[model samples]
Target: MAPTTDPATTDLDRVIGFTIPGRHARGRVARLGPVLHAILSAHAYPPVIERLLAESLTLTALLGTTLKNAEGQMTLQAQTEKGIVSLMVCDYKDGELRGYVKFDAERLARLGKNPSLHALFNKGYLAITFDQVTTKERYQGIVPLDGETIAQAAESYFLQSEQIPSVVRLGVRRDAQGMLIAGGIFLQHLPEGEVGRERLHVRLDHPEWQHVEAMGATMGADELADPALPLETLVWRLFNEEPEVRLLGGTSLARGCRCDATYIQQVLTKFPETERAEMADENGVISVDCAFCSTKFPIALADFVPDAL
Candidate 1:
């Protein structure tokens, strides 16, 4: 979809950015329909895990889309040494998004109905990473994943890691058609310039941030997840009274995974001959499956792996 400047218009699977000029705050609103269905349906994960992944995807979009023009990727990963869910990853590159979750089925089954994040990922830590492709700069922040949901974890990340006063809210639901729809809103009081940032640092607990966050906190999950509600309307409803609410429309997002047969084959060639042989079947074909997209790639061993190694 082409970029739109109108705040009243809406589209499926797009992230819209907005700013409250007087408050010195900026935010991104994400409303995803087809994108969420495409991602969750590919895996058909259990309901419990699906919800967790949904939250992860929404949170990823809320933060990832902020990487405006930079050709880079934002990745969120949660891991634990001992837990039902050992690992979960949600990545966004450009406007593409993908997610992966690994858990012990037996352990997950023990949870009755609703499993809290702490119960599912005991001692887990959430890691948010930003990798700028053009600059080759990578920055990561790790915070304990003790919150009830990924949204809460994100709030903790901004506070402890980014040191930015921010508020994040995410919602996911299965529509009547059984397609997963997710939405998220994020608000941060960004400093105008270096001088302004220095002043902001000196007084990190500014009242303007508190006010913006309070207004954002008033937004409920139902309103956010409503398929009929446009993102621009949500912003308007929340901050119309502010001096200025600047909204920019048109960053389309889709289900995305970085998987290439040739690239996979290249990586396999470096493996030892014995290891490569073990990966092959009777037909000498190595079947590699991508956890992100659930696509299986059968590469002919002779196509890339030499006899020597």
Candidate 2:
């Protein structure tokens, strides 16, 4: 891919949506900057684990933005008991994103510089969940993490669960300034079906889908990682040959950690007195650390909680 020269700063740290009228395809592009670095730098993880988390966050952004609901939550989790990586989770809600990883460092060191999806997670599965706030409903889809990359697993989710023809590409690497930047592109053809089975299935052999998939494939890793390239320019570069391409609204993204003293205390109050007491330090203060952001909240029982209650 050629280097990008477009001066589109607005595209940074956000997800941009678009659709191709002639191609009957729609997609989302997410390029993260400070948000990506802030999340990864907070933890001292191996490069391979960092890359996996990067891709997870990128994919979450891509899939989360597709929700029409203004208050929906999207979560992606990949985990296995007998692998280098025990669990990796990333979630998105209304432009807020937070994620973390739990892995076996000793097992991870056993792998090479780079590890395949199966190598990282043996007999693992990728679960994509969406919590629709308006409808008060939740839906989840799980698929075997068989492919070499998370992108391939996502395509499987679309095929087996959503039944949409999809193409996904994700990349994570240091830029010219040595800052970690993550970017991804997702494309799916408009579904039109077969007249066969009792249940409808997307026609896997549509010319329109084939053409769109070909266009999506041409998107290079360099192009996705370049921060200078405006998202509009990125999409145009890929689908400009089509009759028409429309760019939708964009949403800014930031790392979100919903941890606070009051919230922690509320949770603590519900626990058994003995359990809460056990959690307290010698000074009778419960030090709560957020799993996502690693922020610490210390609450003193002396003043905050009554001895009788």
Candidate 3:
């Protein structure tokens, strides 16, 4: 049963996490669900690649919710030589969410049967970018892929780049029906001095923090890829016991690319006049494909002309 949403209901199918001891306190556990899965399935991807992309998508969405601003987009990108490179970007516009990914078919085919992230991407870097569309500037942080798995790499990224201690566990699996399922949980220690020291220090001393005690749950690809699991059940089974868990309300997720014909025309116009003229034929048409969604956009020579010119 899929989780349903009602404005009056306190419980809705969505990612939920909260800081303990009030607004000033730190520490949180964010969860992801259907909304994220929907966004990841926009493209037809091999099983292993799809799972990795899903995990990245969920992480990006969780971060989007945690880091709210007036108008911005959050991006998670990884550069890999295995031909399995990927990038997920989520835009937050009036609480609506949209995202997409790009992968190499040849590499995806080779890695489809292998479920190991380390095996697929022997060496790479995970990067996070926050772009405030309303403003011209953007903030980005990148870290080396230090861990063997996606979760570990992400955890390392958060700890090293953000300077916030965090544990991120992401899982993707399929069910009997072959639906894709992806879920993730993130736990972070409140920054020091943000909350009272005595209580914060005591909690940090707990055994879970001594070592990575969090375990990522195995979700059948079908379950994650499927459009049906009740969001409440998913969260309850995964993180209900964590004392600090808080439901922050759910956000809708979908697969979408912002590329269009006008953008393609703009790109082609950037080429040197000689190069542009050489590539153009008597008909003066240019065809461009979106790198992320693979959608083709065609522009006419007239469209490339500057209005001022």
Candidate 4:
């Protein structure tokens, strides 16, 4: 029988990253594990598309963790000719994260399995938004689509927006039984000054940079998505060469959508009174489906009118 849960074993459901010794570089590996299993279980997606979304989720989580600035969420979105594309930004603050995506199924279908990010989103621009709940101001960075894959696009975003040089590798795959698995690794250039520059320069000057210094075995898809693999072991296996490597505690990741009745009611109120009445059902209830989570909510007609209005 396939194992259910084993805390001692390393599995495909964890995210791990590492900092290279003597180099101002860091790498990360993340596996969606059971959380992704739960999220996609109820939904039917083609293996290609499923993998795409899964990788996006994992990448989002990794980026969210790396980019620490405020206590609110970071949002990544794209408007494509194929359809509306989106990624939720969740942070460590209060464990709050949410996101959704809308794609043209027909268009995506024509593209076939394993569609390129550029092919799926031709002529689209990426927008990264940072929302601070406590403050009234929301900051946004917009950039043109440059990369061919999600990883490339994201790396471009970081370079252009934050001026941080990073290398990101993303993968999405499914098993023989149709189980979805998404995983990725990110190598980033840590901020450095004169001392740091000198260190990297000396290392590069050495012939060892060209030699294959096998520290550990190459990581495979099975290892990345396996829930049985302990995160620490995985990190050690991939990056034990780094003497100064530090293990930041792993954070739990999930598929969460920030859609509900209250927000829907506020949006409906903005429509004309006639349009609002037309949308009402026979029982005088207005039903709306959240674009993110597909949660349906019914609002009473009386709730539409504000007490002050």
For all candidates in order, the CA lDDT equals 0.83, 0.83, 0.57, 0.62
| lDDT tens readout by residue for model 1, 139-163 | 8999888678888888888888877
After TM-score superposition, the amount by which residue 53's alpha carbon in candidate 1 deviates from its true location, in angstroms, is 0.7
Q: Candidate 3: lDDT over CA atoms?
A: 0.57
The 10-residue segment of model 3 with minimum total lDDT is 21-30
Off by over 4 Å in 2: 1-10, 192-204, 303-309
Tell me which residue pairs clash in candidate 2: none
TM-score winner, 2 or 4 = 2
Locate the minimum summed-lDDT window of 10 residues in model 2.
1-10
TM-score of 1: 0.91
TM accuracy, model 4: 0.77
lDDT of 2 by residue, 74-185 (tens): 9999988887788888999888899999999998898899889989898998899999999999999988886889999899888888877789999777776677778999
**TM-score of each candidate structure, all chains considered together:** 0.91, 0.91, 0.72, 0.77
Model 3 regions more than 4 Å off: 1-13, 22-44, 81-112, 133-137, 175-177, 192-246, 306-309
